[model samples]
Target: MSKLVSENISTLRPYEPGKPIDELERELGISNSIKLASNENPLGPSPKAVEAMQSLLAEAHMYPDGAAFRLREAVSKKFDIPMNEIITGNGSNELLTLAARTFACPGENAVISDYGFVAYKIVLTAANVPFTSVPVQPGFEQDLNALAAACDQNTKLLFLANPNNPTGTYVGRKALENFLKEVPPHVIVVLDEAYVEYADADDYTSGLELRGLRERLLVFRTFSKCYGLGGMRVGFGVGPTELIDYMNRIREPFNVNILAQAAGAAALFDQDFVERTVKANAESMVLFKRALEDMELKYTPSQTNFLLVEMPEADKPLGGAVYQAMLRHGVITRPMAGYGLPNHLRITLGTPAQMERCVGALKAALEEVQ
Candidate 1:
């Protein structure tokens, strides 16, 4: 069986997502566990989106529109992009992999940040394309200079996660623009903006705004983070018409479901819901940072909905122990050992009440672990 597997596939390590609430509850025989692991919208789905999905439940017998026409049109109007340049996916994750598969050839390479989204490496590897991991600079920021230097003639694709995950850092407009100018024209750049909705930085630039600056740029967005539609698994990408057409050629028919299409379109129209979600996340993030300050815990200041907290040094590695302690107290967080930060934990900011509870649990967990 091992011999039958391709070297790339055989050596690959799958991504480990945050633990689900139900799974943690079952494992600990606990009730009412608060999960602030995966960065999710604490406000839940928009009422309009819920209504739209519910209305479509009766149409389950029919297959989804293969092209996601309505959703694409809504996205085009919302973002001011042409419909032909947009493509939908099961999630932004799918589109990322699709880009790798469509562009990367065997023995070629892609460029990604060392601590960027883990899924990029997985997808590139699965496509049998080797990739270079550019080390992050101070404060966990993507080293755009190193990334540009790493690319050569063999580089086919580049994946950049603005307001990158786990570390939650971002690149400013000038830096990104300068970097883009240096990248080879033949290399396709995929800007993964899954958490862009939650980012409030004044200088942060959405790749969509810079699409015209580069011919080979693709911007990916997802409803999973700020829209509270993780369960629906719907995301969209905007790129050159030719690149989008190539991705569509390889896309599975009905890749997005009927309910997802309806909900996504409704979600886009419900600006009030998105505003409220953003407001709540902004307030909760402040509260979490203050709590960490009071606890004398150092953490990465983030523009996204999560914080990467550095645990105090103890006799042993405390990340896993602190995580277990939080779990026992009915609070779930993501340990960052897999990202090579064994002493750090990544925690999602939840609603106000949930944040309070999480702080309390963290306080208790820290005492126990110490």
Candidate 2:
């Protein structure tokens, strides 16, 4: 098996998603567990999206439009981008993989931050392309300058995530603009804005707004986080028409299912739900942050719907142990050992009531571990 497999694929360690509530409850012999590990929308999908999917249930036997025409039209109207420059995917994860496969080859490398999304590394490795993981600045912020410096003639791609996952840090608009200008024209920058809707920071601008700065820039957005369509698995990428065309060539037919297309299209028009969701997240985030302050825990101030919290430095267990203890209390949160922050955890903001419950569980867990 090893002989038959490419070395890059053979040595790869697959991305691990957060633990599920059902699996945790079954293993612990408990019930009513709440999960805050994955940055999921707690308010659920929009009524319009649900209605659209429900309307299409009888047509399940038919194949999805391979071109994703309706969804692409909705996206175009919503984002003011041309439909010809858009490509839909099963999820934005698929688009990332497609970009890696389409633009990169063996001996040509990609660039990413050490604490960037794990999926970037996975996709590049799966494509047999090596990547340079630039060390982040203090406080886990991506070092855009260093990342730009790391690129050379061999660099073909660069993956950047605004309000980056597992850390929740973001680069300001001016910094990002400068970084984009500094990167060589040969490198195609993949700007992933999966949490763009949740970001309330005035200085944080979406790459969609800066597409003209770099000819090779590709911006990826997802329905998973803000639209609550994670289960449906719908996401899309917008870029240069030629780049989009190349990715489309390699995209599987019916990459996004029929229900996902309908749901995503309807969700784009349901801005009311998105606004309500953001408002609720803001209120709940205050409560969550207050509780963390009361516990004297340090956390990275986030622009998105989650916080990256550090464990107490003295006389407390590491993230993994604290995570296990919290599980016994029926609250599931993500530990950050895989991202090399062994003492930190990434927690999603939930409803006020859920956050209150989660805070109590976390306090108890921290006490037990101490």
lDDT at 125, model 2: 89
Candidate 1 lDDT tens digits, 1-370 = 4489889988999999989999998998989998899898888988888999999999999999999999999999999999999999999999998998898877689999988988998999989988899998888989999998899999999999998997999999999998887888988988889999888889998988887788999999998888889999999999999999999999999999999999999899999999999999999989999999999999988989999999998887789989999999999999989889889999999998999999999899999989
Model 2 regions lying over 4 Å from their true place: 315-317
Best by lDDT: 2
Worst 10 contiguous positions by lDDT, candidate 2: 313-322
Residue 59's C-alpha lDDT in candidate 2?
98
Residue-pair clashes per candidate: 0, 0
Clashes of 1: 0
Q: What residue pairs are clashing in model 1?
A: none
- For model 2 the local lDDT of residue 279 reads 96
TM-score, candidate 2, is 0.98
Error of 2 at 20 (Å): 1.2
